[model samples]
Target: MSWSITLTVNGEPRRVELDDPRVTLLDLLRERLDLTGSKKGCDRGQCGACTVLLDGRRVNSCLALAISHDGAEVVTIEGLARDGALHPVQAAFIEHDAFQCGYCTPGQIMSAVGLIGEGQAGDDPERVREGMSGNLCRCAAYKGITEAVLEAQRRMGQDGWEEAA
Candidate 1:
């Protein structure tokens, strides 16, 4: 059986036909939509490498069934920029050198965006670390990641970062 799922991806409306209900949101994005920023690490929800925002909440896309979110708003790393200016989180990651191998950066940044939106990323480093624990940096870039999140939190607030929830 084929089912159609409509999603608002990166502020654009997308309609996808799914032949399999088991197709995950990750595959829907990477395989169908061609938005490959979200990594496929672990694919077990244990790693935050496939993190994305669903209705403004962070989720492990690899574990989420695409058919289950028929009309959801999904935000991936590819949607975080506008015109040429990067999102605050993206800018922060670049500025702080928060990534080394770059495989997990997208998910980390998305998680950071969600963290900021959820008001979990405060001025405290420990708080930010605790909040971002779900995202693991195999390159041992935690210091820069923590610092980037802090910088982005302040920047997003100052820039009035608001998106469809």
Candidate 2:
């Protein structure tokens, strides 16, 4: 049975016929929709290469089923820009040199956006590190990534001081 699924992706309405209940959002975005920014690193939720925003929360798209997210709002790396202007996180990544080889950058930026939106980027490098630890970068650009997130938080009027427990 083919089920029709409607979802808002990258601020655009997308409707597709899903024939497999086990097909994940990542596959739908990459294979079906041709949105290939999200990589398939681990494909088992162990790596954050497929991270995306599900209604403003960060989730591993590889573990999220397209059928389960019917009518849901999904944001991928392709949605991180507006009118050719980069999102603050994207700019921060570039300005801070947060990525090398750039395979994990999309997921890293997506996770950072969610963290900042949740008020978790309050100048605490440790917390930022902890929050972003799920997204691994084989290039070992942790310092740049952390700096970019902190810079973005500061730009958003955060105190830039370590968050108090």
lDDT at residue 151 of model 2 (Cα atoms): 88
Please give the lDDT score at residue 103 for candidate 1. 92
Listed in order, each prediction's TM-score against the native is 0.96, 0.93
Superposed Cα deviation of residue 90, candidate 1 (Å): 0.6
- What tens digits encode model 1's per-residue C-alpha lDDT throughout 42-125? 999988999999988999999999999999999999988888878888989999999999999999999998888888557999
Q: Which ten residues in a row have the lowest lDDT in candidate 1?
A: 156-165
Root-mean-square deviation of each candidate, in angstroms?
A: 1.2, 4.6
Residues 1-165 of candidate 2 have per-residue lDDT tens digits of 889999898888999999878899999999999999999999999879999999879999999989999999989998887679677788899999999899999999999988987885588999999999899999999999999998877775643432111
User: Which residue pairs in candidate 2 collide?
Assistant: none
Residue pairs in clash, model 1:
none
